[model samples]
Target: MTTQQSASLGLQAETKRSSVNTAPEAPPYCGGDTPARRPEFFTTVSSLLKDADGVTVAVLRIDSPPVNSLGSQVRVALGRELDAALSDDKVKAIVLTGTGRFFSGGADVREFNTSKTKVEPLLRTLIARLEQSEKPVVAALNGTTLGGGLELALGCHDRVASPEAVLGLPEVKLGVLPGAGGTQRLPRIVGVAAALDIIVSGDSMSAEKALRYGLVSEIVQGDLVDGACRAAAGMAKGVVQYRRLSHKPLGADAASGQLFDDARKMAARKYRGGIAPMHCIACIEKALSCDLDEGLAFEAEKFQELVNGDQSKALRHVFFAERQAAKIEGVSREETPRIDKVGVVGAGTMGGGIAMSFANAGVPVVLLDSTDEALQRGLGIIRRNYEATLKKGRLTQAQLEQRLALITPSLDYRDLSGVDMVVEAAFEDMGVKKSIFTTLDAVCGPQAILATNTSRLDINEIAAVTKRPGRVLGTHFFSPANVMRLLEVVKGDATEAAVMAGIFQLAKRLGKIPVQVGVCDGFVGNRMISHYTREAYFLLEEGATPAQVDGALRRFGMAMGPLQMQDMAGLDISWAARKRQAATRPAHLRYSRVADRICESGRYGQKTGAGFYRYEPGSREPIPDPEIEALIRECAEEAGIRQRPISDEEIVQRAIYALVNEGARIVEDGMAQRASDIDVVYVHGYGFPAFRGGPMFYADTQGLDKVLATIRGFHAEHGELWEPAPLLVRLAEQGGRFSE
Candidate 1:
């Protein structure tokens, strides 16, 4: 039979089975004799296709390339196709799916805060139409469906997914809640507890887990659109019932006030100072108390409140900043050679973590050390780290073994000869790094890129030691290289553009956020943090206790206080850097001997059980040490400095503004590309709270004029130690922002 005849027969069968009308009134072009329009007649972003198998189901396929984000154009097109499908008598059912790996990436972030977001047929409006459709509608989840994409699926009468599909409502990460009936309909389909966890945590669930959660009716083993069409045809033939998520009643647990109370408490503890999580909980609570329309209105209201709020704007800035940091003005991926095999030269914590990062990405790595003992030890540490992850159920034994096999331990440099790139994670000493690079220059092929994972030292000086200076650059991965997302790609004066571009691509392959920077002391993160740490130490000399200083910045949204971070990182590392710089240190510049004195007493932070704060055995918590407090007093006395009470406000301003001032210098000196790159480094690498943006962003928000005024006041009272950056002065004078 023809498609329209088949659909008519199915609609007649559905009508015979149900007391109420199952089909909508036909439109002008609904009959079998009406010629079907081409797929392109609908919208360019999507195509309308009738199932060739004569199933009487029309498949609306979204074909936007890349992520298939539901932007204004796609929304308008999808709405048009959906309307046409509803009107057509040949289309007994409709199946919505995407062209490739993404069903949809949700609302286009590029369209956010723009007039396009409010253009005709918003995502919410399109979803409303989907939910109210008389003809059965099914979502064929082909791949990753997230945020508004998942919400759109929830609006369908039924959902069927391929085994590879991933689903989530992750708007909370951007500091906004899902506004398109996700908060209301998700709970009705899944229980209140599951919905809260899914929405509030902003985590994706596997298609298998989605089936278990009842989010999808079936996991399609074959083609997703075909299976979805079959499911939709079943509904059309009265073999399956239409299940609109909006009309579904909430589970009995939704009535429990304790359930919501517990969710709120969990969100408070997990998100800590975050605004979206609490607002998400509030919307879910509305689902329990209010009708679907009322709940959806509440969700939209809350979404609007957050999308325009300061926290959300800051978070969105960070999201864009991270992506922008990867783009170089003249560099393109095609110019860079692909990095296939990697080599890591060292076996310590940093080196081992670097090795694991490569292995995790399924790249073969040569982990070279001077001796078998150190190599074995590094390999042991790597295995232990993987074992810990396995115990957490995050890694399976087979996967752990597979990752471990990717890393080949070696005692000879010859093993790294064929590797595309080598990351030197050896000792921080310049001589040690220079010697390694010299040997690598001769031993490895000329095409291999040499990278130093140096935090503070000059990359230019290191590059000068190599014959092929063009091939040498710095890939300064943060401590615990496998865990930290930030990778500062420091380009030296003589480094080739292709080398820098290659490392940038390698950083993406390794799942690191790469920020290109120029050579400087401590590069971007550490250079700026040096001033922040200096201010913290200066605060201690001026009468702020460790607890008070740490508490102040912690309240300011720092992940941890500076002193605690130093303690956790081991004081010996920075103490060594100080000793190296002692000869060149300016006599006029004020130096704090507090850290040196603590190091003299054999206190090297958490590893040694003492530093600025004492740690009890088996605990990471910092306990104030009276001995260190006494040392601070003695240093102040020796320096002939008077101590006075310092408020938390002063502590926060001094510490944070110190970072801001130095960041301004870095930007002006061309060490960093832009002010936002500094923010990206600090937020991703230095634990400067993402919600506050970064130090530079924070300074802009506080007003550069006011910040410069505070710095000038400090500079007058504290000599050149508090010298305001020239860039800050000019910007402040011009009433401009660092971000601008």
Candidate 2:
């Protein structure tokens, strides 16, 4: 049970040789440690030419622009070139490499669902050809080699990589196992434990680590192509002996069995909601037990199954959704403004977090507060945060000091005059925010961008007080700003295009996913979550408990349950907001009083040791309380609501559909550019499960008609609280999806 596939492909017979070479022989082109430049030559995605020596050694370069992704055309071309090189009598050996920064980034993701992916000369066919070629093929990993790219290299007889090259198979992140021999060949080269670690984590390793793991033959410091060519020539001359990865024996024993068992446990815990890691582990186990041909077929079958599954579809939707969020209307063509220095007003919780974000990006920041004591307290929190990071081994002492040194805490407004951008993370009062903006407008430079960190306040009123309305917008960083990855860039009515472009670019620099949203009561995420949380309360009032509601959503892949999230976020925060809006709340609109009652008892949240649930003195774990359930029962009785036994399915449908219905209204209102942008805000900002995509994608998957039918039923039962959005009804009638 060796490899029937390899023999059918006409690979040379396997020869016994020592895998470990005590004194590894260098290639003929090996020079001094100095970085040497590769010989210049023009080449396309697939072209064969000779190295500096002569045409005796054929050199094939994959030169597709932006990372040589293996599309249909590239694969077909490489197949043809490989056949030609193998047929040429003068060509002794072939060296394969990439032209630019990446050797190959894997498959063209854009072609995943298209017919091109299934066309002739597929990646599998090309890699098999490389494995069976008469002439020895040396893979020159020029830079980053990932997914199918690494599989291609594994097919070659030998591999040489540039020192800066990074290699891995990250298909697991996208909810699919690597389809192109990655699972089978990788374990054969780097043992089972390392293979599981690399594949399960879906992380890239450095070239040095690749060499150490015997994944590559050598770490070529300079001129990757030249080194590969020399290595190929050595193999042709019998100076170097390399074995095919497929023919290697899988030393499966008790230890290997333990490794697979451990991998299963890890995948079940870390990636509970996804099926990709489990599939990856299963493929590796099959590879070890079966022959190469059977294992390959098994891998291909599993790959097809996972790729067509809902989880992969949802994950892929998220992949494209993030890219779609980057294109802001009327801002893509504008010249981005330079922001070298940042100023943060109100050195409280959010202000300190925002300041730390800028400082972490190596930008100098001025943190301003009204009193010296306030500034000192804010600075102390930043120090403790950095110290925690250092203790976790995430940051060095130098890095902590450098980041801390970038933030200058002060009480004076004059210190912000020299900063390029000023963000006000003050209290969420219109008057208080307007006063700060007015002062910033008068004191700060005209070119500086004025931003507010208000999560729900109107940016227009805050900008109206300042003469430079065009320079004002909202940068709604989520709670604990420095740790969160979402930055909702709220566009004001008078916001300039350049200002939007600059902030978008700046968000990327700070390692955040920036989604452009129009100014409104809660913008995209919070506005939609309002409906979601409302439904959760309604469920509670009916028959469900906090633990029941949270458990249902958590099983559905949410990072946290709505009630648990409310408890952790402090129920009083939203209670105060509700009190402010109560004056304007419509008379007919249904409102739940359970949360208000909890707040009335002075139970804030984890901060106050009780809210939706009680917490221990030092622990933040939510402990279900019978007293809270009694209170909910009383509220329901007073509201004349009949309690019914609610299934988990009903709970999930009510909560998720609420988000979809509200998201539709937001899209119809043009607050968000597209449905995908709304999805991005939720996935990155609101802890919506990435595997389920976002509410919009989930709606599409469930079918708009089905969603509408459920909503219509809810509307009939719950009245205005569950009213189907006009957009949802329209799309359902038209048979259109949100993605379209």
Candidate 3:
């Protein structure tokens, strides 16, 4: 029989079966009566039933909770249901959907490297079966459809989605291109340029955009499953054609070499040193040039290659590490308290940023300063920041006003009495922090959690000033707090478990990654960064120029070179800390006076337009300075040290390994709960590249034995500064990994 004839007969049989199975007294199979043939196998990962249309449109709902990830069980269940629907004389069409907020979150990331991923009827194989189905399939996208989930939808003969649904192919974010037919089929529907943007950028597209791109046939007004079933019924009745995406021809632009070339260039610029974007472009090019089967095979080949590569491993490690950072050993999320209002003390850059962080999250904030001038200045700066976002079209005028209104500036300490929490972003002085806490204890309610935004001050001592020490902890928000994602929750000795839990929950509400660290000087990120910067300064003292040292690190995927970053952050800040520690400094230990001398000259970095590098007026770009080069030589000569040529290899090892060594010490000292937590801090707070999986994970990738050997060599040549941590020594001896 012809395809149309078969579909017509199937429809007739479906109507008969629906009438016979669904009783007249019952509303429908969904409401009262059970379907006549409810398969036991479908109860686990999916459910099968007839739609309200009284036609046998087999509604196969993915029942996996949370995100309907297509794990082995889910894939197997879905395949069996598809087979059952196809064989059933009563079922004329199929409607695939999912329960909860996600149509599917794609493949199970938990099964990425495991044996289950290679099981028979893999996602690719199941999608092939779906594409070749004789009966039409309609995808009912209820919510988020991403990665392999989007790929599955493309295999369907037709697609309809709820207005709230979002779709994307975001495999490149996990360091792999789309392995299924996403690279090939997406281009067939959305054209080559649009597909390249979607897949390479790994950003989600809204249902409206999906409709505009022809990715979804229609946006359902009411019930998504009902609309999808109606669409399926139309195809079964031959009113709508069962159009296969595999048979669709590539657009005319697909043949343009320049198109692919431009995409490759854009990918390189946007995703520097990333291999996945380049590979994604290659797969899309294959779709343009090769047949569907060949393109799919090539995509799978590339996917397997990337998934097994070191970059993908590191990326995946980071993906899990971020989630792992949220958990505390003794604290449950139930202990967390609601924080409706927050008070930020101090009206400088850090203080203003902290207030903006709360205001952006829809939390009311009281921004307190010592004087009216300072308070207005801080509020003006916040307004300017929001105005800049508005200019970029990221914020509407009403949103900008709403955020600004959330921050109420004040000079009186009494304004903080009713706040749920108070974060004192004051100067980095124990005396000053103590004074603020002492006042806060008297002025604020007993239940209010008091926090200090100190980078390195002893939090235990700060807690000593307050009567309710259990309510005191440290909330170290990174600079430009609203922009940076890290919030190091410092758990002081007397800090209550509930306080820690509360801060962690609040950090998430503010869109920050909170890593719980025990109280210590500089905590994890700053303590490790102290060693990193020390090595960078030492490299300069040893004959590496500012450009050479920074260049080497930049080549290693650092966001900015050490000297340039110092320049941007201002050199005066570290100069004060060094000066404070000078009296207690051990004379025999090496110290770089380069930064101090720069500060003495009043060239405190970009603020002064001259430090390690010179800058033009109104520009932040660092220019190589001959004056600073001469100063480095003078400092070296004064210390009676001879400068020697340094290799870029040595530069990277000293800088990165310094972070690794100190991170190990922090973990051992109990300042950091685990090595991966240190990685989270650096990756989120310190601009450490996520692709390298942060410092500790990078050390693991280099092998503990290899890292120990490098450190031992440095120790022999450079004295105590390069001494390997005991944990590193023990791990190296045991052939263990820091990541574990």
Candidate 4:
């Protein structure tokens, strides 16, 4: 602790230690000839009993450094000062302020992890004293007051806030709520409707709005401590008016017949899997109709239930896990490379959208294509995207125009002169991609980065063509790039850290989540996706129809099943990639061998009016095609693979676990930095269900041992394709998560 802070705390103890461990009725601000007092206390809380002329006011200051958390020492010292101010006849109205910038910031977050150290009742007892004090208690909110901090201010008779202050109950965001009298006091003042809104949203309002909502009594601009002392003096002399929070009658619109019913339904829709918002609604309704004691009792009972629930635990885990993920393992703030100008090749759907993302964040972009017409079309796509944003009120016309003006589209390769980086979203063919890189190598500056948007290709080989191979990388973007959030940043064998750092910065600017991955055929995302589709195609080889598989996946919350998704994306695109891989597939590894056969039969998905299922031009309905089903049975019979009944559980498990097993392999091989990074890709790139957590988290939840056992069982029954990843086996044996 700082020397100044320790001295202030010592003064607090010297002034108020005599009235320790007690709560009592208080007196006015001062009496004649009263001695000025400073007390000895812990570094957490500070106090001084000063006489302004004839009136003495005990100022209880919470001084715990770094947010002044309402921890054990803070409660003890603060309770002591409240006791002295209430019992001493020499002391009149009390003033409560913080030593530094912040008032109490609620209970210490670290302390909440324990079961025994929570001292809410002790804090409440002191707050109850201030609420019932004969002498007025004024709160000086000088900073952001939240959770238990706001609850403490609620206990004061009058609240005076600094202009810079914002007060709210933001606890709901962290898997908990304001259990320390927030439910009772907030509804008491703001009423159930407004209080419930604030609680559910977890958004803090400004001091100005707080005043408008009657959350605080006054807004003081400068010298907040002096303003609080003046209020104490005014109250002591009967010069300024103040209202007690406890005596205020409840508002008429607290809860009518339709109010609570509407609340339950609304919460049901928005918070589908979430339980906190629903419990918050119930507590608010109880507060609306019940007495103060009854309301508090109900609030405590509900809090007890939610704090011990599984949903809270899950939400809390995700919260902390995300914080942990943001900190790069070996990279520090100083080592990160800055990105300025970016160049994007092809100027097609993905390239234009990707370029627009960088330009939107004020990064200069050079968009390259072969012809002026193609360049114009790409620029048109950028403008149309912004214009749509303007139409939707997501951006103002001027802002949209500014973003549009940031991009420079041209047909010449020389236009990429000073760009810090270039992402090539050219044709999927290796020959076409390699030719583009040769051109990029000749045109772009030596220091400039070159990245390809190839979904499934050898990044290392592509890097081999460049003079500075370390400057080349893979920046794979999903289809309709502007909409999707994930960017798989693939690092080649020779890729430099500065090149990666530049890409990471560019991804952040593009409003895309960049996850660093190692170079491989498909990197992390498409590699797993390829495995998922293989299992789906195999399911068709069995007795289960395509509709049955789609039904099962949709029931499990997938956006679309494999067959439907293929039709939407145009199956020929995947068929082309399949032919590339089919040339080298090992005889031992299981291949469904159904996709290309369908494409060869002139089924190019919805674009060509047929795929796994037939599609009518405008309508997406895939009517049961006897032709496809017949082909599946014929292929299975010819291959001597027996058809059997596959249960729904079997279907879901096979599809999910195939991807999970591949994800394990990627983690084991160091293709992905972390398992959570794999989860982020699936969550953003693929339509992975969030409620199940990510695939890795889901695998952990399902038990890694069990997942490994299942995969081993499949490997024994099937061939080499079902071979378990070493990481999965290790995690299973050690009983640790992939992230662990």
Candidate 5:
């Protein structure tokens, strides 16, 4: 038990002064046992793991400098300390745990490959020393035990865990098998079928479930370290019993592992083309057929295959990219403002949904509209979304009522006072949004920040009308804002760093991931749309039907094809924008002309019952319209465009590269901070496959050189739309990444 957390009643020795010199201090991120430790960044690890009370039931607490990763220093210190304790005759039992909320976040990914050769030898010595100790060993799983941390815990004689603990060997999620004794020991303990499930899926399990599976010997009701000590004390005198996982005989024979065969069949179907899941299956097979050491050897081999692999490296890059993308220059994270109260202007789908996002995060929301009917409709939608959550067991009735109470619907601008921020989610028109901001500027206090939920309009233009333009920014939430994780925080020309910081903090308060962007029409999300749409049109003209192109892109993991997405979103939107684009075509962009012809007719989209695809009432199924096909042919004739057979490869390449090209342009224009930021937007807001990473990531992986080559070829054939970015061309030629 910790003074910083819950105190224990059983400290025989009186607590002494801080052991700054004698003991290793806990780092800031790891946390410590002091009043000052309440603020995580201030706590020193030295105070948390003081050697003053180093005793028989010593819990080797780990919360490594940050993210408690199992790197070289951690491994060395842990092994050395445990060895010293085991050698001391007075030490009867050792209980290992971690500080604060987490145990260890597995092995330190940064040191992985560099320490690969040394890993097996170190692990063998550590496991041997721990297992062969005259003193009993107990592992107190304080929080998440994943990868090698789980392996270390599994090696102990007894396992005791807290209720909040999550246990698993989740290396496979990063496309690698658990390298340290996972495949062998886990299957031996939990049976082949259960072990395979965790290993293959790379999914974590609750401590309660782990207890049911007999993974942990006991569960802690109160403080975790105390429970661990009690268990260790019991086992020290032979009161607690445990079976070594390596020595346990199977309940059923080896051939009885037909259960695993069936599981593998299902796993293969579930995890198609993925290597780690299959490798996990093979590890399970080896565990059933051979001894523990043999199984561990097999696991090690598979781990090597994964560790040296390109996929795992790509996954690791993405993992780090997500963490790094959150940093904002000139914005002090220490100055994060509290977003307890919010105002939502508009009683439409976006406003209602965004209001729900705030309420879900325990912030009160004031929803405003012109009439009670519109306000009631927005409230009704909020209620329905919460009701759906209730049905899914995600929200309790009491919790739902508490959240619903947070949202106060009103029709007057006077009610918007005393709010930290106001999100104007009104219609996507400049005049309406500007008028709302103008009204908000006069009504709200000087400190209140104004945010517009506009998708394509310029944030700078919206902020231009406000008295305090520095406080005006764009919080562009995707459709169904509550459900979508991505929030693009557009920093206007005059937006102050504090205001930008507040919007980012507000986004975090709403349980949304925020990526800061610069002001521009369509910003990052829709700008990329031009490329994909152009390719779709080119495909249609080249004798490929809309169905063919749609099928190809959809098969490649896009939720919908470019044409299909246009139809679903209503083509008239782009059609209206295209009219302006056409007037300034040579100045803005090169013309494609294919989409204009489709839109010039009364073909709006699903809303108009006709576009690229025909729709039946109340149905999502898209039927390719032959009428559109005939029109395409006629348009090709009128435009004197040559019609020819198109390949699926051409369709996929042309469409996707257009997106990459546009992204390069966005990056070069300083609209985006980094290429990875763009990827994050697409990954969350758009349906870019997680496995393939996002578009920018995908481009990086494809070898920028190769991408540039494709773009160059497209440029020669198709003109300015295919013109590669100067930066992109340079990076590609230098054999570097877009993010780099």
Candidate 6:
């Protein structure tokens, strides 16, 4: 403890003795002429405390639950307390602290797009009052202080934070920039470059790092409020002068044109079509050149624009959809079965990644394979993955070792006998999956939940081989499972509701977005993506070049074009799936043979250096190939179809609408719980741009009538291949959106 804190708080004797077991009594207040009095408390969303020391300093504790988001009520209460504290001559200093896990969660996201947010004493207005206060105001950051919360702290005269506190302005991720003076004040404290980086990326930094950057005045060790009280008392004694960030000069010259230019370029490449990141850079640049008030006005203007724009709307939809997807009706989390130990079958890429995910989440994993050699190879792959992440500075060596220690590799099924759950990520063949499940049923304990990681196989058929089919479900993790965020929890016809609920909880615990889907040839994501890729193939055969089609969708904000996506995923994989379906394919249904023909010619995408496009040695970059074009033309000729020029708009509509049409069918068939769940699957797993929402939301944005007209036009031209889904037709006729 510092000497000022010792004198102000008067706990030096108790702290120094070390042998005192009793709780230390409250010390005398640091005031002159007036005797100490008991604390007088006032309550709202926050609690206001007038200390006994002649009320020299007042402590306001924000008590909003969960994250202490600055809702309108909290803002109103805070405003009233600030007025009271400033008006009272006895209260010479004011200290602000949070009561729980968050110092503040920033602005209340739930209040966005609502009247409550615009109520009296807006976050901006409250911040202005905080900055303009005559008495010294100290912000005691106790925990996660973010967004408007950090902006609030920036406005205070002095800032102090706990060692474990994390600070950030993360509005960019929600497709907006900080509006409450964050863009202007942060640069003055952390410099323009750092402010730009932090705001653009929307990532939090540890309080220790904040101290190094001089963002915080002090790092309080224990009892954050008490330290803040002592600090406030010292300010009341005129030991520290009020520091206003707005009055401070920026760390860079306004004429340093290259800094902003570089930042803009980086944001453009990193965030692509994301508008908020670029806007954030502009805000920081404006802060460097303009006055504080002018910069704040500019920031608010941009923030309002984003809050009303389509990109922010889509991002917000995704945020809410993620929360809604977790709320499975009739399934309570309280009845969830415990999943302490997990077993991952197979030693291929998918199985290894799944094992790593469990280990990363601090869960013990038994990785079972058919042979010792295969088990060793899988473990080796997992170690290399961790080492690569370590090289990228995402993981420490100790963390890598700790996660690795949680995975136990074995060659025998008996080793998985004690596991509470077993995930079979074996080959995606029905016969193979059934055989694996049969063995698992025999070896695993009766309570073990059997999960299949099949991308497009029949979960019910696989479950039928097991004695306990009620406990069997499909937990489909996307490829490179540990890295992907989506978990398609496939609910089989006979799977228990409690089992699904348990898997839902487990997926969240493993840090994945679990979307419940019913059993089908290809669950929600792949089912919808099937039509998306099919349209891309049709477009190719209809005279659209790979570059033309891919470029249009990429510009539309898809992470990768369909052809390029195929190349990256290995064309042979889809070709195999197609061939498997060929036996059952309806004769009237038009099946494009372009991809299959490419596979037959020994062009299997990145794995073989050629598929829809060709690749150079050691590079995944796809180059347009004239040979593939010739092959596509040949297929068109063989199918007795005439090729015509296809426009980019047509290409995009065909691709995305195909997804919408299939998604509508999935929802109508009860294969997907809701339209939003399909959206969640696409956004998290399929690289669908969050800014556009998902296929279903995009359809709503485009209008169901327009989409229906387009689908009808395609159906007239291509017959069965472009048939409109029945649900789409109904919704269009009624002028209703998929969300309805």
What does candidate 6's lDDT look like per residue over 316-375, in tens digits?
788778877876568665777989999999978999999999999999999999988988
Candidate 3 deviant stretches above 4 angstroms: 1-43, 52-54, 248-252, 255-259, 329-334
Q: Tens digit of lDDT per residue, candidate 5, span 1-740?
A: 22222234343442322221123333222111112222333212221221213344655666464545565555666776676667666667777777766676677666657744375336545665676677777788888777777888878887878889988887776677888877878878777767877888778899989998888866777766766676676667676664555643333475355777786677655544456777887877777667777767787888989888866765666565565555555767576566679899998889999999998998998999999999999899899999999999989999999999999999999999889899999977888888889899999988898999988888888889988998888988987788989888888899888777777767766777788888888888877886678778877876889899988887766767888888877787787766755765776544556677778887878887888989898877889888989988876777677888887788877887777878888888988888888888886787665556677778887889999998899889877778888888888888888867
C-alpha displacement of 172 in model 1, angstroms?
0.9
Error of 1 at 650 (Å): 1.2
Query: What digit string (tens of lDDT, one per residue) describes model 2 on residues 173-203?
Result: 8889989988888888787778888898899
Superposed by TM-score, candidate 3 places the C-alpha of residue 51 at a distance from the truth, in angstroms, of 4.0
* TM-score: model 1 vs. ground truth: 0.92
What is the RMSD of candidate 6? 7.3
In model 5, the runs with Cα more than 4 Å from the true position are: 1-11, 14-55, 116-134, 166-170, 187-206, 247-278, 281-290, 587-611, 615-618
Off by over 4 Å in 6: 1-44, 50-55, 248-255, 332-334
Better candidate number, 3 or 4, judged by lDDT:
3
lDDT-best of 4 and 6 = 6
Candidate 1, residues 1-740: lDDT per residue as tens digits? 22233223322111111011112111111001122233332323444555534556777877655566787777777887788778877778888898678888788775668787799899999998988888889999999899999999999999988889999998888889998889999989987888998999999999999999999988877556666776787788887788856554354456688878898888776665888999999888877767888888888999999998888878877877887787755766578789999999999999999999999999999999999999999999999999999999999999999999999999889888999999999999999999999899889998999999999889889889888889989999988899999999999999898888788777888889999888877888988888888999899998889999999998888889999999999999989988987999899899999999999999999999999999999899999888888999999999988999999999999899899999999999999999999999999898888888888888988999999999999999888978899999999999999878
Worst 10 residues of 4 by lDDT: 25-34
Q: TM per model?
A: 0.92, 0.91, 0.93, 0.77, 0.87, 0.93
On the 0 to 100 scale, the lDDT of residue 172 in model 5 is 72
Q: Estimate candidate 2's RMSD in Å.
A: 8.4
RMSD of each: 7.2, 8.4, 6.6, 8.8, 4.8, 7.3
The per-residue C-alpha lDDT of model 1 at residue 379 equals: 95
- Which pairs, if any, clash in model 1? none
lDDT by candidate, in order shown? 0.84, 0.84, 0.84, 0.75, 0.75, 0.83
* Predicted candidate 1, C-alpha RMSD: 7.2
Where model 4 places Cα greater than 4 Å from the true spot, the runs are 1-272, 292-310, 329-335, 478-480, 505-511, 545-551, 554-570, 597-645
For candidate 3, write residues 12-58 as lDDT tens digits.
22221221111112111111112234333333245456643456788
